[model samples]
Target: MKQYLQSGIVGFSLTVVALLMPVNGIAQSIGSDKNTLPDIGVVASEALTVDKEMLIGDAIMRQMRGQAPIIDDPILSEYIQDLGNRLVLQAENTKFPFEFFVINNSAMNAFAFYGGHVGVHSGIITSADSESELASVLAHEVTHVTQRHLARRALSQQRSSPLQIASMLGSILLAAANPEAGMAALQTSSAISQQMTIDYTRSNEQEADRIGIDILYNAGFDPRAAATFFGKMAEEYRLRSRPPERLLTHPLTEKRIADARSRMARYPEVRLPPSLTFHLAKARLLARYQFDPDYALEHYMAVNEQGNYLVKEAARYGLAIALLANDKAAQAQEINNELLKRDPNNLFYIDLATDILIALNQPQTAVEMLEKEIFNKPRNSVVVLNLANTYLTMKQYSKTIELLRDYLLVKPHDQLAYSLLSEAYKSEKSYKGMHQSKAELLALYGAYPNAIDELQHAYNYTGDDHLEKQRIRARIQQLRDAEEKLRNF
Candidate 1:
């Protein structure tokens, strides 16, 4: 699987560069503006087509999902996607749909790939002092996609060898997922013109920063958060010999910080209300991924002792989660109970409380809690997924299937939901259902060939069921066609 993914990565990178190479007219125009920034409008109008860009983006995302430690938590994924979609609504010239993902890495970095896919590291979320700061980072990455900066650079540097461009892009995608491997790729790729690439990237950085501030302001976030976050990154970079992955790609400089501050000064000072979800998300990341459970428990306990009420509450939440991770379910339950009393409607509290009930072997209580939430928010993915999980835990296979089938109709690509459905199918001893669910799960991870094979196995297992066999055959054909299309790329 590793080798298959790596080969796909190389092929996709090469295809992206080849498709982005400038035509004769574009090449001539680039020759005249060799010293200036490429006309973004010209590149936007005439460079890589949207279809090809989506294909490239999809390929890169699949490879990353297969290779990286992506956080598959539905609650966190839904939170980030909601935030990103809000910003996307206010963004201009958004040619593609935006998708957000969280990487389970402690390094402070966020990156945008082709087709509006943005990924933020868990560390960046935990490091943020305010929601606006996190929004600023996301806004910057969104601008990169909106402006088509990567495609423009690929076209402008078409004069370079194809091998060089592919190597550079491969390194970038790798760096976005794994910093060490990316650094190694950079060091080994002798064909790349390091200075030239850096200069181009620096220019794109400035443009993204300028436009990102506008997006942040328009989206009702504090624009100054961009400058604030940049300043913080700069200070951290100075103190460390090896800066974070963000500095490695973004390359913060004094001029950039000054320019951001200058731009932010034009907007009126408007303070937005704090978001509870932001605080909860940060606390969750810190508790779940950043430190050992015992250390996180101690750390949050110390933090809770001296902070303001909001901070203290957030710290308490983190401490509770850490305690739960350490298997102290009773203590965690107490904390969650208090939190729910304060805000019963908050999904964060409800979800954690449900998990606590399950951990304590009180599935009936969890069922009742989630059932009420699902009644209020019938179509909420987080609530639905949690309820499905609760049902699965109780060995209520039919209820699990019935609940998830409707939800998956709307969200067919959700791997976690499909995984739960697969378990439910196995518990019910439905071989064909199990194989079909497994196929869908594999397809979500971009293993199309494997998915086709799964369906073929399902077809063989469906003895004397002509309709089911025919359905499996048809699904296999669709998977094959999809695989062939990607292969052609």
Candidate 2:
């Protein structure tokens, strides 16, 4: 989150080629005597089993890691995941592990794919006027995953090969991030007519909206949020020459918005207080992700002075972030100190304070604060990652390595952890460890060959450690097998 990001090209180009592979019968409908769509539960599994869906999902997710501008902030991730899981708890037909992540894009879009992964763009958070609006969007995406809409789409083309199915699925996923490119891929990848895909996708949206509202209400969000958010979207984009990515993918019609209103009307009206964390999250994005430091500082200062924000503390939090970014670490620390005094256990304040302390050259103080927080919430990602970062700043390489190694047990796919571990290994002159960590980082981006090369370097750097050499060789082989698997798919 602190660092700017770059999407890789190598794996992305490979996946784009895969998206161009031809599918012969993707447009064909199921042979039904009644000319009716079959029940998804009965046939979706037959076409694309859960295991195959997950495999394709993993491959695409790895590519996205390499190609998409994904945010690696632990605090933001924790907040979004917590919010997503609350709605997931009320969802039905959830068959796989759900992962929530944010992409560092200024587009109003959210997408869900196979393997229960949902991605939100930063613009969606900034655009949302309330937590319930954000939650409504998440609930819709969750429904898409749980209902297995993508797999059901595959079920229509039962005569197609697995490779064709994988290509088609990949096209839909690609469209979520890059609409024009994905549309081209979809056209070449499938024989399915554009209208047909749109029709099916529209149907899926209707179903998702119906179920998402229930999930949102059951999760304690106002049901009317669904309709209100839809109205906001329609109004905002009504006369725009180019609508956002979400509108492109979702295709919001007047009927859709009206349907949302009618459906939400069934539930009794409810009024809820503002969400502090949601505003804080939005402010964090504004202060750190979107604007320059100086502009952010001025914006937050105005918000704080005028008290125009939904939450006062969130405005102050933004001010602190802007202060930190502007190199006013002492002022940032003072604001953070006040915030922490008010809510000593808030992870948001703790993480910001950690950054401020490190900036002030007080690594020991940051370490002491983070360590205490970690002791109380042993698995809290915010505290753990902050502590690991503090250790790296303190040049406690061994401690950094140890903490990240354990943290990876829970978040093996965390690219930031791998990067930090690699830095620590390099600083400690552990060439083998450094190469091994770098290998994992590359592998996460689907650069299997590069990963294998790094493992070989690790093996060469290995001393007389027979077990370590063997492990490196095994890892190299695993990457080779994975590369082969992806190639075939």
Candidate 3:
């Protein structure tokens, strides 16, 4: 079973990398101008258009969802997306929309695919000592997208057979996730020379590092964090017989570390304080993804025992989450209440507190609290989703549907909202409504064929409701159009 799962993951990862490859003629001009940094925007401007990249990215993302264990936590997704966008606003030549996701893997690595999709492993978040360190890695990945390194590589090596290029790209991605598997893939493929691939990858890494520091500095993060993180990774690489997956692709050498430090020296030293959200995000990964509630509780208790007040508070917040996960609802509630006393307006504390209340079988209390929060922060998706969940728990199917439907109107791409709406429809015994909600959810992941079939089922269930049937047919046509557009790439 383990081998089967591993094979499935590798195959899926390859499909993702394969779909992002540049078309035949798009990359021919990539290396024509030696003076230019393979500026993908200039070279493939006509061939590898932004719209095509989006189509490719969206298609691969759907395949990934179907195969990988991508975390579906809305809060974590929102936090990472916000962080990526913050950096994007400061980045140069960003022509595509940036999307961030967390892979439920423990490998200390991150990667950027076509378009602006960046995937960070949960382990990296837990590994960082401060928010800036995490931001530094994200900045580096963002640079890859902004500079168009992947697209350039696709264009530069367009001479290689498609299968060969796919194999190389797949190996790089596998290496980012697991070094052993990646190395094995490389050994099996004779399509590309190891040394050549290494040299090109090194150049891309250097360029991304040089540009990433500037983006990090401009975005108000301490640039030194990049050097610091790289230095740490270098040491880890030295200690291990086989380096981590990140080292295989990034190749953090002594010179790279020194260069990052030199770049940091150019900027004024800034001791940016750690962000609370960063701590909460790390805590969420520990309590949820790691599935080690006891370990989280113990680790946080130790940190609280010796750390400063700010650190202590962060640790306490983590402990509360751990407590909740361990089914100690009352204890978690007590900790949340105390935290709320210190900062009553903290959404994180309030949301967790509301969750504790619901776990304690106090659904009405959860509803009252979340409703007030929603009124205060009307556009807050997290609070609104929480309220919708509370309504679902109370078996108020109509209220749940109404809230989710209204929210979905504004943010139709929200996966969690669609999922909740589907559940509400199921509870209400509305087969047509249930399938329709599911269709929207599937469509978000680029599962157009499945989505179309779902709408067809809904149309069938509509029977005599001509109006509803017409609406379903219209949505099916839209899905077909999207599928056709994807195929054009």
Candidate 4:
């Protein structure tokens, strides 16, 4: 129901590699043979036979984590979870467990993985901003899972074996068993698995859209919200000057919009709650993604009461980010100062202050500010990272290592944190610590494509005598080859 995103690095890379992975002759022909695509009955039959779709869902979660961290908020998650469950109550399959998660990316996208796995982006949450507007998107994604679109596609890979099934089940166990090993394997293997998902067809998307419209009506949400969202995306595309059809989409074309409009006219529609989040989310996105910093800033400045403080801060941050992108340092600094005055202790504000200082050549002030934040929140991992980066800017290599050591205590599994930590250790001439940290980082985040620049510094410090260096190097090579193969997709 939602469009796939990150077509360049994340999506394309795996697609490129998967295309090269040899498929059986029958498998190759089946994809081309639309006639051979399984019917709904057949798909349902297969789905029933493999009741452990839960395992597949778990694997998908693991693979997702390997690539990036999803934004997790307990209260918001609970809100979404309740909404999803409420909708599912009337559906045929009451036994299936459904999960909805928010991926923390700025890109405006959402998707359903095979099984009942569904994800919305933080951007979508910010974009929808309203219970009803958000519900419309959920209605669409839920339809994908409810209709078994992915399982039908699985049947397309006709002649899939038991081993494949075993691997699917084993995937989550592997991730749980050795998260680092599994994550590394995923970075090495994810492209191959997801390649099939993208080029795949979906007769089900149309079916889901049709069904979702009805669901929206029944749930007391405006059916028009669906078309409204599609129109919103189209408007975004035009305003941003994105090439026509740059994103392959369905249910958003002019005909689709017209069809929705006609359908809306036919239905005895109920009024929707005047949702407040759509414009705010849109404005925030503009601040983050648009090329014109000044315009984005003006847009937010004009609409002071449209959204919450978080939304306002986010908008301001995005505006400042846009200014920095355009190399407007002085203006950006002014904006940061304004924000800092408003939110004196906000972490993001502090981070932006650091950026402004860096741009202004006030490295010592940056160091002082970063140090204060780090000291005030010793257990906070994200803040410590900001401090470490500031240390790197100040060339206080030893201090960088010390702060990284503190951060690792709370966030051992964060690969970037560990990678940065290893760099700090190396800078301090602590070769043993560097060696240990690099191996762990590689094990967790994958060693491919310049695994860690800090690891090299660590090696320089230790005089390259570390025994684990070769293993890390070999893994890095595998990651690089895999990454290269994925580029074509």
Q: Judging by lDDT against the true structure, name the best candidate.
A: 2
Clashing pairs in 3: 27-155
Candidate 2: segments with Cα more than 4 A from true spot: 1-38, 164-200
Which regions of candidate 4 deviate over 4 angstroms? Answer: 1-109, 114-139, 142-148, 155-158, 161-203, 206-224, 233-319, 326-330, 345-347, 361-382, 395-415, 444-489
Best model per TM-score: 2
lDDT of 2 by residue, 1-489 (tens): 253244622111111101101111111221212223224554567767777777877876887787676777888999999999998887655666788888877667787776778888888899899999999999888877766676666666667666666666566556545667767877887634522353336777776777677778878898898888888878779768887667776879999998888776567687999998999899999899889999999999998998888888899999999999999999998998999999999888988998898888988998888888887887777887788888988899999999999989988988888988999999999999999999999999888989988999999988899998888888898999988876676
Write the residue-wise lDDT of candidate 4 on 195-302 in tens digits.
Answer: 335332445444555556666666667777777876776777777755222134332567666766665654466775443234333443455443366675565555
Runs in model 1 deviating more than 4 A are: 1-42, 157-172, 175-200, 308-310
Question: If both were scored by lDDT, which would come out higher, candidate 2 or candidate 4?
Answer: 2
Model 1 error, position 155 (Å): 2.0
lDDT of each: 0.73, 0.77, 0.71, 0.53
Kindly provide the TM-score of model 3 when superposed on the true structure, using C-alpha atoms. Answer: 0.85
* lDDT score for candidate 2 against the true structure: 0.77
Candidate 3 runs further than 4 Å off: 1-40, 159-200, 306-310
Per-residue alpha-carbon lDDT of candidate 1 for residues 356-441, written as tens digits (9 for 90 to 100) = 88899998898998898898888787788888888888999999999998998988867777888888999999877888999998
lDDT over C-alpha atoms for residue 283 of model 1: 90
Q: Candidate 1 at residue 225, lDDT?
A: 96
For candidate 3, write residues 325-406 as lDDT tens digits: 7888899889889989999877778778778988899989888888888887876777878888889889999999999888
RMSD of 2: 6.5
What 10-residue stretch in candidate 3 is worst by lDDT?
A: 18-27
